[model samples]
Target: MRGTGKADVFVMLAHPVGHAKSPGIFNEIFEQKGLDSLMVPLSCRPEDFDTFWAGITAAENIRGVIISVPYKVPVYHKCAAAHDRAARVQSANSVRRQADGTWYADNFDGVGFIDGLKAGGHRIAGRRILQVGAGGAGASLTYC
Candidate 1:
């Protein structure tokens, strides 16, 4: 169903993509919504990142990319534009191709966590939350 026509392709990029859950999750969501899209899991050695990214960017049908692990920051730096969340931390877990084929970056690491909390009926406005960890994901959480 994916390679049939002009479906918007999405790539989940990680060093070792074998463990990626996003492609399956997103694919399931697309199926449920009847979206003409596909999320494909892909990996390349660190050394191949630059070349891989170049090729990916050249793909006119690649509508978006979900970045993970070591490539988030790299991909963020390559974006033509970014949300404040991503700009502040210099990291991006997601990017979508712009109309001109450039990428626009954003990070939902923190937003998703808070949204999950809110969905679970946790009061964020009048309560406190404890966070631990460091690096890209940590910085994003702190910024949020």
Candidate 2:
């Protein structure tokens, strides 16, 4: 059974999440692993972020959140703690609830980028890499 009341919940949060892919990918992983979990995709306008975040933080059953786009930097600020990757970039691609119910942030954009390149048989060691954007995700790569 999927997404029972007792299931562990996760959220993918972005401002305009209609094109997001992580929720479907993660839900499929959970299904294949036979985990009682669900990943929900949610969106909120920038003006309503604080209210939306407060409610999300209060949902005790939500085990984690994968953040994207405009929310990454802001979500990093909301964390009680963070890994060096997130702290360095001041952006959070992912966050998990701590024992105290506070979020702990981690940004994997840089790591993921390099890993993806390596997986595709590309090397970054001797290349002049040019990242075009300067958004939250861009910060991670620039500082990674």
Candidate 3:
């Protein structure tokens, strides 16, 4: 809880968010960069999504959100704009608030996955990729 009244807030919105590690990772990055920002996890069930999104949107300090799982597609539809990749996959893993107070959605899971593999010395070119599951994450990876 490194947040202060003036800190820019970012949220990881997910159902069953107890397993999420984004807050720790983003918090460290913010601290290292000397940023007055905080990323927190918000447990939002599918049914409560609308209310949660509405509340967060009205909060001036909330600058962005990382959406996950059951809310990805729904959030994508609600966004004012979406990246091509997100539109193709029909899912969004992140959203940023625009100056006009609208949110823009984007999908980065696939890119992140590939980047991680490349960082580990794995090459994707000419390699057959086999992924299990056809959920939001899988759909994003497949689209990439």
Candidate 4:
């Protein structure tokens, strides 16, 4: 159950059974931080969220969850609360469990995208961006 002791975070990717790069990306970060956390890819469908989340959340030491495509909107509806960014975007890519056992949803894709662009020396303060996508990932970039 969750490898061993506790997981500082749990990642859920909604891709309907496909290869994902998130695991490698997040696992590397977790390793660097020396945190007792792991991001796993759950091969889930759009309808298995309730049961899946119930089982995972019931596990000990799972501090948070990462919601991906197809599951984002559903999880958004189930979240206890959402950050201002998620609230405005009506979507979420991350979920954190609060001290009071409440779930908080937040979206980081927009900021990450902006940061990625800025990292490449792109001035985005007042720049026009033509993003491509209408799904969850697209919604994540809505703000920018």
Every model: Cα RMSD to truth: 1.9, 0.9, 1.8, 2.7
Model 3 C-alpha lDDT per residue in residues 1-144, reported as the tens digit of each score:
356778999999888998899999999999988888999999877888889888988998899999877888898888999898888888899989999999998998888888899999998999997799877777888876
- Summarize candidate 4's per-residue lDDT along 42-100 as a digit string, tens digits: 76655676887777667656677777767777777767899887887778888888887
Which candidate would rank higher by TM-score, 1 or 4? 1
Shift in Å, residue 114, candidate 3: 1.6
RMSD over all Cα atoms, model 1: 1.9
Q: Model 2 — which ten-residue stretch has the worst lDDT?
A: 135-144
| Alpha-carbon lDDT, every model | 0.89, 0.93, 0.87, 0.74
Ranking by lDDT: 2, 1, 3, 4
Pairs that clash in candidate 4: none
lDDT of 2 by residue, 1-144 (tens): 889999999999997998899999999999999999999999999999999999999999999999987899999999999999999988999999999999999998988888898999997887897789977778888875
Give the candidate number with the greatest TM-score: 2
Off by over 4 Å in 3: none
In model 1, what is the error at residue 9, expressed in angstroms?
0.7
Better of 1 and 3 by TM-score: 3
lDDT tens string, model 1, 1-144? 544588999999998888899999999998888888999999988888889999999888999999998798899989999999999999999999999889999998988887898899988886776777766778788777
Q: Please estimate how well model 3 matches the true structure, expressed as its whole-model Cα lDDT.
A: 0.87
- Stretches off by above 4 angstroms in model 1 are 123-130
